[model samples]
Target: MVDNRVNPTSNMKLLLYNQVDGRCPFCGKNLHYVKNQIQTLLEIAHIYPANPKSHEAELLKDVPRLSEDVNSMENLIVACRDCHKKFDHPRTAEDYYRWYDLKKELMLNDEAKSAFFDNNVEEDIIKVMDSLLKIECESDLVQLSLSALKLDEKINKENSFIFRKKIRDQVVDYYPMVREQFNELDAISPYQFEKIATQVKGCYLTLIKINENQEAVFRMLVAWLDEKTGKISSLACEIIISFFIQNCEVFS
Candidate 1:
């Protein structure tokens, strides 16, 4: 059979390697090996088979594909040789869906990172983090009734049950205190709360544009805020994000 697979350029290879962080997304093995000399062990695998055999084509015909063009960047991934071979042979619907989901996650992560540079929250958002960290007494924390949580209304069915439960728990634990802190910040400096809320909303809007999955956007928002706040507790970021969801700054 004539080989029709086009070899990826050096730049494309590098981009693929970087996207997987120099490791095989499937096996978690390093893409390179170094003993006597550095050797590359990575293979660019197609998320959708480029040239499926008759049986392979039939198997995947109804499966969702990342792109119609199998050679597109959206349909490529960096995998170690072993995983590449394993995934290609005996390509069951289960394995196809698994790889498809993994590639989609990687793409979402890359888009989220790129979007962070354009839409970022202000440093003033850190004040909320500081307040969370400074709490010395359990009495300082405020709780809300479970019935008051808006996560169900704000979040779509795309969100996982675990994520929904987590956001609900955080909102129940910190909603009132976070709201009070924002109100106090506004009192001290007029529009401070609005400024911070607007920045977060902008970031959320930018992320949703990349991927509308509520859980994906929520996770990206927490990650962006965590970085902006100098790597503060992710729990604090989650609480703040939940607060904004309640305030209609996000998921609205």
Candidate 2:
């Protein structure tokens, strides 16, 4: 009983594609379903096809009756053209479920990476500081200038002992600061960080200029914000501002 009346709104279709990472869960192909694809190549695959009496429903007999929401986001996933056909085939429910679980894990990690790279946390921080301090942003971006110092500290605390040393070595080579004097950049509020870096490190750290490598780091951060998902939420912006304000590092 393939009911041909299923129609999903454009918005719901986009939401499903994003949730599925714009790929077929089974074949993991983006095909024409890419974000900017001229024409959508994805089809909405329902775990429980609209008509409960359809052949696909036979496999979902184990699903609780009350839990069934045929149109719910939980019951739908986006699939590439070929995968969609295979998914609609009877007796493939179990296989699709496995891919769905994997998609969830993949999306979770995607979110974490977004928080680190794609989310424009750094740029938003700059806009905030500029407005709050009433100063126009200069050439030195959040990532371009002091994050060079903050990187080592974040890596050290986040990594293991041996791992920490290896990462620190990379940062040293990348930015090559004169001394590791500005390690506490993100330890407190941005105001305090500015106070310390400007008042204290400005005297000594400025002596060691930014090398090509540090500039490259700055470009990388900029590109990430540009290429990745849009900037973080208003709440995230506030959190970063507060982190800049409340954080304190004694490495001075």
Candidate 3:
């Protein structure tokens, strides 16, 4: 009998096929769900991708249950109802992900395992470096400065000041030395991925504060981003709109 615990939004199908092992997680249709018994039946669908505009940032910050909770593995699951229509955006997993335990347990992939471990370490190091950079630039007055740093290679020196200011003073002025240290640290330290989620939440909060009273600047900044990646968290947008609603006098 297939376990009836995991939620089966279309998004979970891809996750299950790629990430899970055995049985249809939503319906009791594991090998049976596989068409011709030759290929597995499944698909991956994002639960909240449809209604992303409706998501408020604060809700994402508080309710770990929300599909916006990018940190937890539980945010996604496997489902087989290609026809069982419900919410269109496919955010919530009503079934839960316990059905895939067998897959995680039985799959013995030495190379994949090594790569996964290495990636986790890389993520952890990136998170720490990000935190350190945040502290260093807290007074820089740019909301997405750290994320901007990731785009340094692509930044046009003439227009880059809209986000991060150019630095040419003190120890940081020795750009090569600073780059060397960061590269060395990235090479040596194992990433603490477990902490990344917490950092993301914190960064979201910072993003909110920075955007609150600076609509023009915020909008301009977002304009530079690619359409697919430029949108701020719906949660952040909600907070920004709410502030204006509550303090219309300040704008006047």
Candidate 4:
């Protein structure tokens, strides 16, 4: 995996990150927010060399309007440090083809699309959100979170059609509202989401100190299931616990 540090100046890095969902598209390594002290490993890589003096960039000189697009979203991608360097080395034409193949693989993902339609939609949401949190650039974090939500909604369009409609119809039940709010990030915007994440993150760290084992964490989480308040509270607690357990690795 590429471990090169990224510059704080570039918004394109984050934009590229949002495009690939915040991981190395080629190696599938966790790029965003994986470390504690050090900077992120993900960086913006232009498919066509951005430098006008470079041979690869020169090749595009004959192609109309394409050379100018070297810095455009269509031409930029997120890559790990190693991949970024390797992409710049030898066999420019062959590397471009290989890069294109990797790009296709990233875009045409069946698993991410299928998960949205499957029983694991919540898990999928958390996964994408986790990536958003891990991003090195803090600029427009909420915007990036919102984009991730929209991308998921775009996936499995046909499958989500009926359920999305049902969500639209059902107002009282959060089933629809939860999906809609997340899709739009309206009801609880990304900033609000970050606040919750911060609170929960503190709680999670405390839990680890108390007991590092999963069983201990589950028992503590189970305390809420016994709440005399109501079933909704219990259900909410369960959902929280499930998300924390499933993504405990995100923080560490």
Q: Looking at model 3, report the run of 10 residues with the lowest lDDT sum.
A: 243-252
Clashes of 3: 24
Higher-lDDT candidate of 1 and 4: 1
Q: Which residue pairs show backbone clashes in model 4? A: 2-81, 2-82, 33-134
Off by over 4 Å in 2: 1-6, 18-22, 28-30, 33-40, 54-58, 63-68, 113-212, 215-252
**Mind giving the per-residue lDDT tens digits that candidate 2 earns over 185-246?**
34433333344323222322332254323333323333333343244343322323223211
lDDT of 3 by residue, 10-129 (tens): 554444465545544445566334355666444443332322434433333333333335322344444455512333333333321223242234234424555444445434434433
TM-score, per-candidate, Cα-based: 0.50, 0.43, 0.24, 0.35
* True-structure lDDT of candidate 3: 0.36
Candidate 4 Cα RMSD after full superposition onto the native fold (Å): 17.4
Instruction: Give the per-residue Cα lDDT of candidate 1 at 71.
Output: 81
How many backbone clashes are present in model 4? 3
Cα lDDT of model 4 overall? 0.50
lDDT of 1 by residue, 1-252 (tens): 755477788988888888999999998999898989999999999977888888998988899889887888888999999999999887888999999999999999988666444333355577878888898987987788877777778887767788888888888888998988888878887877876787789889999999989888999999988887888688889889999998899999
Q: Please state the error at residue 186 of candidate 3 in Å.
A: 12
lDDT tens digits, residues 91-165, model 4?
366677677666656555634454333423333344333443344663522321322222233223443455434
Residue 4, candidate 2: Cα error in Å is: 11
